[model samples]
Target: MGLYHNRPHVQDIRRMKARGEKISMLFVTTPDEAAAAAAAGIHMLSIEGRFFDATMREAAGDCFVQVGLPYGGWGSFNGRPLATAEDYLRAAFHYAGIGGDAYYCAASYDIQKTLADNHIPVVGHIGLIPSYISWTGWRAVGKAADEALALWRHTQKLEEIGVFAAELEVVPDRIAAFLAQNSSLVMLGMGAGPHADAQYLFTEDVCGYGLNHKPRHGKVYRNLGPELARLQEARIEAFRAFKADVDGGTYPAPEHVVPVKDEEYEAFLKAAQG
Candidate 1:
C-alpha cells in the first residue's frame, strides 16, 4: 500500500500478508520494466541478480524487489553456476548491499537456511520448480491429494527454515489457497490461483513478447511481438538504405563532409606533393 510513499521494508511485506492483502508482483529483466512497475505502484518485483544493479534499484522506486539467485547452471556468473551454499550466500549479501529487499533461492533447504541465518530474507520455489523440470516436466503440480499434501509439507519445511516467502508455481488453486491460509510464509503465486498472497507474472508474458510458450495462467495485456517485428523490418530497411547510399556515393554530401580552410587545404596538398 505504501508503493509511492516509501520502499516497503521486508517487515512491511510480511505485515501485508498478515493482513490478508493481495499483492501485485512482476518478474522483470530490464530497468525500464522495473521503473514502470515502480511508477505504477506495483507491490513487489522479482529481478535476477545479473539484471539487478543500483540503477535498477533506483528505477524500482518503492516496490519491494526480490533478487533471484541462480538455482543451478541455468543462470551463471562468469560462465559458472553458483554451485555451493557459500555462493548463494555471497550473492545474497552482494544484492542486499545494493538494496535488494529479498532473495529467491531454489537451492536445498540447508542453503536457504544459510541465507536466512545470515539475516537475509529468502523466497523459496515450490510446485513445479523450473530447475528440476526434467523430473516434473513442466506441468501443473499438486493436482492429486498426495502431491498437494507434499507441497503443503514443503511449505511448512521452508517456513521452519525461516524463509519469508515461497513462490507457488503451477499448483492447483485450491492447494495454493490452503497453503496461503495455513502458512506464515507469503505465497507468491505464478500459475497458482487467486488466493495466494501475491499474484506474480513475468513482464514478458504480460507484454506478449515471451520467447517461450506461454503458461495457462499467463494473461497477455499487450501484443508487442508484432510491434517488435515491424521495428526489426524498419531496422533492416534503414541498414539497406545506408548501404545503398554508401555504394552510390551519395552519403558523404557537402554538408556531411568536414571542410578545411582554403589555405590549410592548399598547404596539405603541397606538403603531400612534396
Candidate 2:
C-alpha cells in the first residue's frame, strides 16, 4: 500500500468525474508503453492481468490503473476455466495485491457483485462487449429506442450492484452523455462520446501499430509500423555483416585477439623441445 501512496486512489478518480474533468485512459501492454504514458501524464491505464506486475505498476507511476481480469473461459486455473465468483475474486485479489487501483471485469453481474461486496473497486462493461458479440454483432449498440432503454437499465443495474465504473463502448453520443450525467458510475467511454468521464483507447490503436481494421472511433496519432519495419531491417543487416566477417576470417583478426609475449612463447617452445 505504501508503494502506491502517491498514485491516485479510487476516490481521486471519483472526484475527477464529479468535477466534470475529462480523463484520458489507455490500454497498455509493455513496460515501455506504461512508462511513456506516465511521462506523458495520461490519467488512467487499463492493463490485463497477464501483463500486470510490480514492474508494470512501477512504470505506470501515478496513473490510476485498472487491471482487467480474464472473463469466463478465457481464464484458467489448474486446467479448469474460471467460471465462478470465487475464481474471479481470487484473480481480483492477486492483481490488487500487485498494486492495481481498480479492476475491469466483464464477468456476470453476480461475480461483479462479489468483488464489489468485498470492497474492491470494479469497472464493468456495457455496449457491444466483444466476448458477447455473438448477440450484438460488431457494431454500435443501443441505437434503437428499446435497446437504448435496455442500456439505461443495464447501467442502473450496475450501479445497484456497486460497480463504480463501466466501459461504455460504441453507443450513441446522446445516450452516453445522458448516462454519464445520470448514473453514479464513472463512464470509461471507448466510442461512447465526448461527455463520458474518461476517453479510453488501446495504445496500439493510438500508436498506429494495430491491424488493418481500425475502429471508427480510434484515431492514429503516429504511424510507427513503418519505423518498426525499418528497425527490423537494420537488425538483419547488422547480423548479416557479423556472419560475413566470421566466414571471411575478418573476425578475430590480430587486433581482436590476445597477444602472447615473445619471451614467454620461446620459453614454452624450449621446454617442449627438452
Q: After superposing candidate 1, which stretches have Cα over 4 Å from the reference?
A: 1-5, 264-274
Tell me each candidate's RMSD, in Å, in order. Answer: 3.2, 3.7
The TM-score, computed over Cα atoms with residue i paired to residue i, of candidate 1 is 0.90
What is candidate 2's local distance difference test score?
A: 0.91
Clashes of 1: 0
Which consecutive 10 residues in model 1 have the weakest lDDT in total? 1-10
Tens-place lDDT per residue, model 1, 1-274, is 2234478888899899999888999999999999999888899999998899999998998899999998788797546799888888878878877888899999898999998999999999889999989988979999999989999899999999999999999999999999999999999999999998999999999999899998999999999989988999999999999999999999988999888999999999999999
Per-model TM values vs. the true structure: 0.90, 0.87
How accurate locally, in lDDT, is each candidate? 0.91, 0.91
- Shift of residue 173 alpha carbon in model 2, Å: 0.3
Clashes of each: 0, 0
